[model samples]
Target: MRRLTAHERALWARVAASVKPLPGREVPKLPAVPTPAPAPAPVQPPAKAALAPGLPRRPTAPTTKPKPPHPLGASLDGSWDRQIARGRLAPDRIIDLHGHTVATAHGVLASAIVAGDGARVILVITGKGRPDRPARIRDELMHWLERPDLRPHVASLRNAHPRHGGSGAFYIILRRPK
Candidate 1:
């Protein structure tokens, strides 16, 4: 065994002192952390002053008038017109284009109209478009209806009555299969 040097002896003495437990003393406990207070909410701005001083502010009427159910078609034949007006021309089949992409809607709509089977009037429900993106599917569908592939299958197209779907949907009249 090698004899300890003077410097090594001092280091060992320090280590021995640290390791030795105090006989009568308890270990000191850590202090609790203080939590910070929450920030105050921002105050809202006051309402604008009325136009006139004393006169009560007249309730403003709605800017746009409510549109009546206006049916659109290629010169509706007498009986068909009467039936449509009376809301008696109920759709034999229905297809909703909600949550479908433009490409998907195009393919599905074309296939549905082409394979309309025995249905005379097919109801197409393009949900009243998102407030952010105006009548996208509805406009696309209207344009799609004019294309050669889908056009042959369709005889007439009309805006559905409020009961059916209002401005958001169309009533597609399918041609009789030969």
Candidate 2:
């Protein structure tokens, strides 16, 4: 393999600075390039502090609020909304994950998604939690779906209707396979 050029080494230095090394591992640093001392700039007289006549001062950037994640059904079209509202749409595949632990559920969901059988809509059932504590599986389902490989396959996620297990179930609308 050829040695990295100066440009490649410089790019690597920038990349290395941004990463967090694993425990007991150190990030390899690039050799420092010695910059030559600059020639002295000529001294100049100070100008008036007041702005030049008719020149408008630029406005400072506005502070933006962090928007919440988009609502589950927002991106879906009217037909999807109508079917979901009327509880008329039937799921093509049903993956019941009520009893599985986090790791097992994650693997199953990934495998099912990757090895899809042309399912347009999948109903995922995560059992409702006890009155005192929220269910871990239910909470983590969204997080799992957000993985890079799965997110593209999924179009939108909606809470299932009462007939379809209500809040304990989620309707995963898959994008039409191209």
| Candidate 1 lDDT over residue span 80-158, tens digit each | 8678778888898889998888899898888888884788888899988777987778878868988888877888888
Q: What is the lDDT of every predicted structure here?
A: 0.78, 0.84
Which candidate number maximizes TM-score? 2
Give me the displacement of residue 66 in model 2, in angstroms: 10
Model 2 TM-score?
A: 0.59
- Under the 3 Å rule for N, CA and C atoms, how many clashes does model 2 have? 0
Residue pairs with backbone atoms closer than 3 Å in model 2 (clashes) = none
Error of 2 at 2 (Å): 89
Error of 2 at 154 (Å): 0.7
- Over 4 Å off, model 2: 1-72
Q: Predicted candidate 2: what Cα RMSD to the true structure?
A: 19.0
Best by lDDT: 2
